[model samples]
Target: MASTRPRDGASDKGAARSADALLARMTRASAGRTAGILLCAAGAAAVSVALPAVLGRTLDLLLQGHPDAGRALAAAVALTIAEVVLNAAVALLAGTVGARSTAWLRLRGLGRLAAAAPHGVSRFSPGDAATRLSTHATEAGAAPAGAARIVAAVLAPTGALVALFVIDLWTGLAFVLGLPVLGLLLRSFARHSSDSVSRYQRVQSVMATRLTDALGGARAIAAAGTVDEERARILRPLEELGAEGRRMWSVQGSAMARSGVLMPLLITAVLAVGGLALADGRISVGDLLAVSRYASLAAGLGSVAGPLGALVHGRAAARRVDALLAVPPLAHGQRGLPPGGPGTLELRGVGVSRDGEWALRGVDLHVPGGRTVAVVGRSGSGKSTLGAVAGRLTDPDEGEVLLDGVPLGTVAADVLRTEVGYAFERPSLQGATVEEAIAAGAETAPRERVRSAARAAGADDFVRVLPQGYATPLEEVPLSGGELQRLGLARAFAHAGRLMILDDATSSLDTATERQVDRALAREIRPGTRVVIAHRLSTAARADAVVWLDGGRLRAVRGHAELWQDPDYRAVFGHADASGGGGNR
Candidate 1:
């Protein structure tokens, strides 16, 4: 059973480090956008100072018994309008910059994950990866937007306080005195609240995973009469996620409430002091009003601490992205392959392991170039592992796998992929049309070659009957298992590589279509250099040589006719006589 316990200290530390790294990467990736946003924030701050300064001057003009006090009041009003306009412009600019930066970060991070995630990692489920990319990227984006707001909010108030000080230094002193309390609030909230936020994010991931699993296996669950049970299992995680969300919100709400109380209370104190100064004639009424405005400004800064907290959260989220980015990909393969005939394949003490399980044991095998070889094995017999090694999908753990006397690891991956094509047992098609799927990753092949390959794979007839034939989009079209297999075969044929490894590629097709494809492949393919991993005895029986594997080791390599004589071999298919034997290999 899977463990339900949450991760512990070491894991949390690693996650935190990863989150930090993600933020650093986001900073680098969005540097220009950040600069643009900061510029807007600075402008917004400057505009915010205009209103208070102008209002103070207008009041001063009125108090001096200016005959044109009305004009001065009008000027203040106009300045206030101008300040609003400037604030609007800056807000728009900052929002645009933040949006574009988020897009770039999300796109690049997702692309890198898709590319680097295929090798080495064993637990990168599609559902989990999708959740990480989507949720983490969204949370990370909040940092920049929040940072822009925080910069403007902190600066406008701070600038107002400085201006107030220039008018009367005591007011500035009062503003400065309140900052220690604000700092305490920030530190306390951040230290305690960050963990809750991280916890909420983790719960969200678990909920996403469970939801994806339940939806993807809906058919299976219904058929097994476990729909209600599966639904409960998925909903349980979501409930846990909701509880975590509530806890975080409660913490945030309490911190915000305390900050809210402190800000206005500090403003009231400043007002009382300013009133005493005004009554004593130590400060003019205009100066008292300005000091009041500054007090309000400081209180406004306290409110901004909320977005500031969001900025920190966003930075933490970006750290997750950074963790993924820092993981190095497998080194690029060499540039070329050694010149040799197509079929000269050899394995020298090769082995492969994944997550501590030896997928393939140390084994040596050599097959001379120019003949069809069949690999016969039970399920989990390392048959697919051998095919993967031969195709260079992965590197071996212990020893060398050579193609044409050159170690596969030394040959460039692109070249290896081009020269050694794989037709998987259930090939993943990646195109709108049959032709497009066949032409995938084979840039040099022409449309005519794609057609020829389809015909060779016995796929031409069904394709011709489609609404648009080669132009028909695959999305709306339904294909049977056999038809899909034929399409996979068409891709292999179109590739025109020297070494072709078909891993149970014909298993789903009827015997007639299967034989037809086999015959076509035999005639068109370069006569010797083919490896067929098959569960069908009919396919193996036709190969030039059959290498039988059992219990992770190769037990025999001989002609099908010779193998038929072995009682153990015959017994495998539950056959008493050679001619009577017919079953999946």
Candidate 2:
């Protein structure tokens, strides 16, 4: 159920705000570097202007056989060298600023993503998120540097215009006349290319998302013999991406062609005007050469097209990064749980909705401390939703969840996490080694404790046989589904929170192993509340109590032995009786 449609207007506005915030952050981070870059560029422009003027004076002195010709030549050479050095400094500083900014943006984006809610993070596919972090981050990072170049580019033309006027009134006027045409061309390109670039980037993200989805499910697609269909589906966005790219290029090409034609004509007109002035003895040949160079330099401002294009692309990319950052995180209060309380859990009038449909509604349940409760339901009956709310993985839209008499939302994040542990159906083990993964959240957990937990979860024997035992790298050890599930259970056991929630965490285990693990949980683990989302009837049969849900409403909460007497309850598992004992074995 990933969203394939483009974002709506309100989301776009939020993204714009995020983009602005990011730009502000970049500006703050690199203020000193930005200042240095602008200073160097200004110095380079000043030197560039002085060079042509000095060269013109040298020419005049040589033509007249003046005694100061050598001095003028020396001044010209010094100005040329100064310009080169200043330009080089600008490039070096701008590059450094860009690199630092890119690093900062990527780190910030990742931090924001980590803090965002699970549902919010799910909006982006893995590949799309990677592109935003890598490619889009780099592009957005170049904004500060590109902005500096743009300023310098504008300054060059302005300085050239001033120098031209200083040389001769008629030549300056000739250059000024073409300004409106160049401005119009740039304005049009900027307007057209911004939309084109934004669309192109969106299409790129979509294509990446589709590709990542295909790769992750490659085995399934191949087994189903639908490889061709999957490939076509993944590549479907390429056609739109190409069209957007072509539109951008066409806008740029048109601007360049127009500027190309207009610039030479303007330069030729200025040169013709200078010639007329020279023939009338109003200006020297050196003056004519100086004015011509100034006019060309000013006309070269049209080449700002490249940097302007970068600015546009970077702005669009920043918006994409900002959209992810804009996802509001779950709010947690500043209250800490009271000390020395039993791990009692309660849900009062709890309700949850997804896509405008109720996943759970008006649900009221309570589990006393030291009791094990099983949540039983058929498909789409809110079993997982209840587990998630119990662990505060998500909060209900209505009512509240309480642990030990305090609302879950009121508990501080650290206290809540350390007190309530969860294991999912498909666990993500994220660490370098097996031991590290087990001890991930509880970093201070002792090695002995980890081993004990592994044994309790029926994982220690297999782990001991690995190449490096608990130290074996996760990638180097290829584990089956059941093994992975056992490791996940071991991780939860190692943490040993006051309240443990296993949301179908034992589904992959065989009957004997699961029963052994269950027995170990009862005998070895600390006494606390345990909420298990059970898919099999046998699992429910073992629990002290069962919370039966039907169509998002709590149908009953009673002992498993008592509930089994109801034919409707047995029918949920498509069974006549609980005599078979082994469910999904």
Candidate 3:
């Protein structure tokens, strides 16, 4: 089952708000850059407006048969030079701001995700998360700056209107008639383009998800001889994605065709009207020419339809980007670990649920400073949940978990994270070298500490056999599942947290190796709290106390020997038979 909720029908107001907030932050973040951008946009608009008027004046001078037509033409040439300079400046600013804004938003989005991810979010796929943070942010951030170009495109029409009114009010009114039509055309394109672009985004997301799944399952599919089936499954979404792309291009192509025809048609109608007015002597020959020039300027309004198309694409991308940024950051609770004690972990009537199904219920457990507690249970019996709760990898749905008599939420995130160490059943190697993996995210851990931990976990021998030994990269050395698990344990050791929770950390080791690792851990358990969640009953048997969980509930808490005599515990360890009680290794 999927782990995250679908965001459908959710209030997008929050997303818009976040986008605004991000922009405000970015504007403040890059104030110097923004000032440069605004100045360039204003310059571009100024030139864009001046160019059409200069052309109108030059045409009017020529029509009036003025001997100073050469001067008017020279003025037109100067206006052209100014237009080029301004346009170039605007383009430079747009590109610079677009790139910078994309970077800012992408970084901001990642920060939000990191802050929000600590909360139990099972459905967040790594592949999808990458898409949301990178590509989506890039597209969204382009919208505001790209709007500058659209602003210039609209300026053409304003300049045209001013020139037309200068020619005659009737001619200007006639030209303005086409404005509504152009708007309707743009509105239609925006609607369809936005819809198609959104669909394309969904299709791309699916293809990405399928690709990640196929790659992750490549080993399984090859072993099962179903490579062809998996290939077909992955290809299916890609094909759909291709089809959607073609559909979007077709819609854009159609919009382009209409724009091409509409602009020239409007121009032709204006010229014919101007020609008639000229014959009737209601407007001067120069006035007619200026009106024609203005009509031509108005025709440039169609140019915005293209940028408007870009705006729609950008807006669609922005909405997706904003959605990621809008996820309320995991409510940051109190700072520092709870007061009144130190390094004593407590689960005061804690429970955890996922999708309304209880994973752990009404369980209260504690590991005081300098003590060890072993949690034993069958698969799906909540042992791991108990460990996760203590480590704060997963928070409790009810009640509270405390470190040193203080609620876990009362502690700062970094403090809680650093103080609690977790070794998972199938741990991930997050670093390149074995040493680096062992050190985890810490800035400093002595080589001796890492090697010592590896030796205690029975991993040093294999690590030494690799080329370059501890310096050998994790990818270069083919470490097996058991080896990785041990390295993961060594990482926890290197971290040396106040409280350590090993959730089935040694499950992959052989009986002898498990016993060796357990003994080493037992020797080192003093002065640091340890909570081991293991399936093997033998491991729990040696603990100071045993916690046996069943059906998401803590069923028994007693010494290993005492629990061995109980029917429920006997059944759990397969010791119900008269032949033998559950043996401890």
Candidate 4:
């Protein structure tokens, strides 16, 4: 249902604005490094412009047999060294700022995804989310430094042009004549580069998404003998991805090639005009050399293309990253339940919609504390959705769920988590070792209690026999489906709160083992309010009562023996009640 949450209304303009704000925040977070980059770049540009002017003065002084020639020449050398040092500093600072910003973005983006809840996060695929968090975040992180570099790239050429004007107006005007063409070339490259990079990155995500889906279902794919088909499906976007990549390089290459030819030609024209000025005694020999060098520096506008392209890619990636940020999380309130209250749960008019269809509607139910209720239904009958709602894994769209007379939404997060426990049909084992996996996320899961939980879930024996017993690394232990389920159950059991909802959590266990687990849960484990989303009639039979669901509605709540008297309820377990029932009459 979280996967079907419809993206919570993200518009293009809104996401872009959010992306802009995120980039701005990153820039602000690294303000010191960013300012250092700007200072170094500005200092480097100042040295670049100053070097040629200083060298020209040195040349004039040496030719005139001036005694100050040695000092002038030394000044030029000093400016040259300063330029290199400052440029190096800029590079170092840029890398540091970029790295810090990337880490910050990843943390915030990851936190946002975590707070969104499992159901809400299903909107993004594993691959898509990974790419957004990893690749796109890295690209977006460079935006702050990229912007600073761009200012420096522009400032250098602009300063050179002004210096040229100071040396000779005619030479400066000659260089200015080609500015329009340079602008056009850069504009075209930027527009084309932005389009191609966006397409390329999007296709990369598509392939990654397909690849992740296939990897998750690898066993099934092999069992179905469709490995080749899946390979083809996953790689289907590679061709388009390649095309976009080539187009990006083509745009960049074409612009660079054009600039390569145009820049030298403009420099030649400026030099020729400066030569004429020299012949007319309008400028000296040193002035002509400075004019030529300044013309080349002014024409360095072409070099801006590289950094500008990076900026475009980063901005596009920011949009992708900010889209993840735009997903609103499941908000919780600050209210806590009353002390020592039994975990009675109630749902009133609860409705959950998924992809324009109601998965659960008008479901009003209640369960007293410390009792087990089996929720039985057809596959799509909202049993799991109800479990999620009961524990607030997801909030209902139209109604409220209450625990101990307090709205679940209003419960403080820590109190809510400590009070409700859940085990999933396919739980992801967390942590590095068997013990840690069972006690994952708990602040203080004593080792003995962890062992007790594992024993109750029937995982203790296997864990103790492992190469290192409970200390065995999870990677070193190959677990079957049922074993994995037991570990998940143990995790839940270790933290049995006032309310525990098992959403088909025992589905993978063998009959004997599952029966043993159920018995242990009732006797060996601490008791709690239990809501079991059951697909097996045996599980329902063992519960105090059954909550039957049919087509998104609650049909009846009765003891399993009583519900079995209804033909429709029998059909839910793939039976007919042929002898003594007429649809619960």
- Tens-digit lDDT track of model 3 for 337-409: 6442347888888898976899899988777776778898777888877887787765788989888877777
Error of 3 at 145 (Å): 1.9
Local distance difference test scores for all models: 0.74, 0.86, 0.74, 0.87
Output the lDDT of residue 2, model 4: 10
Candidate 2 has which clashing residue pairs, if any? none
In candidate 1, how many Å is residue 59 off?
Answer: 1.6
List model 2 lDDT by residue over 461-486, tens digit each: 99999989999999898999899999
Query: Among these predicted structures, which one has the highest TM-score?
Result: 4
- Clashes (backbone N, CA, C under 3 Å), per candidate, total 12, 0, 4, 1
Residue-level lDDT tens digits of model 1 in 430-545: 88676788888746468988899999899999999999998899876698878889998998888867788998899899999988987887896545477899777788788889
Off by over 4 Å in 1: 1-15, 65-82, 117-119, 338-340, 442-444, 526-528, 564-585
Between candidates 1 and 4, name the one with more favorable lDDT. Answer: 4
Q: What is the lDDT of residue 474 in candidate 4?
A: 90
Worst 10 contiguous positions by lDDT, candidate 1: 1-10
State, as a TM-score between 0 and 1, how close model 2 is to the true structure.
0.94
Query: Model 4: per-residue lDDT, tens digit, 68-155?
Result: 9999999998998999999999999999999999999999989999889666777778888898889989999998899999998988
Query: What residue runs in model 2 are displaced by over 4 Å at the alpha carbon?
Result: 1-18, 576-585
Clashing pairs in 3: 3-123, 4-123, 336-412, 338-406
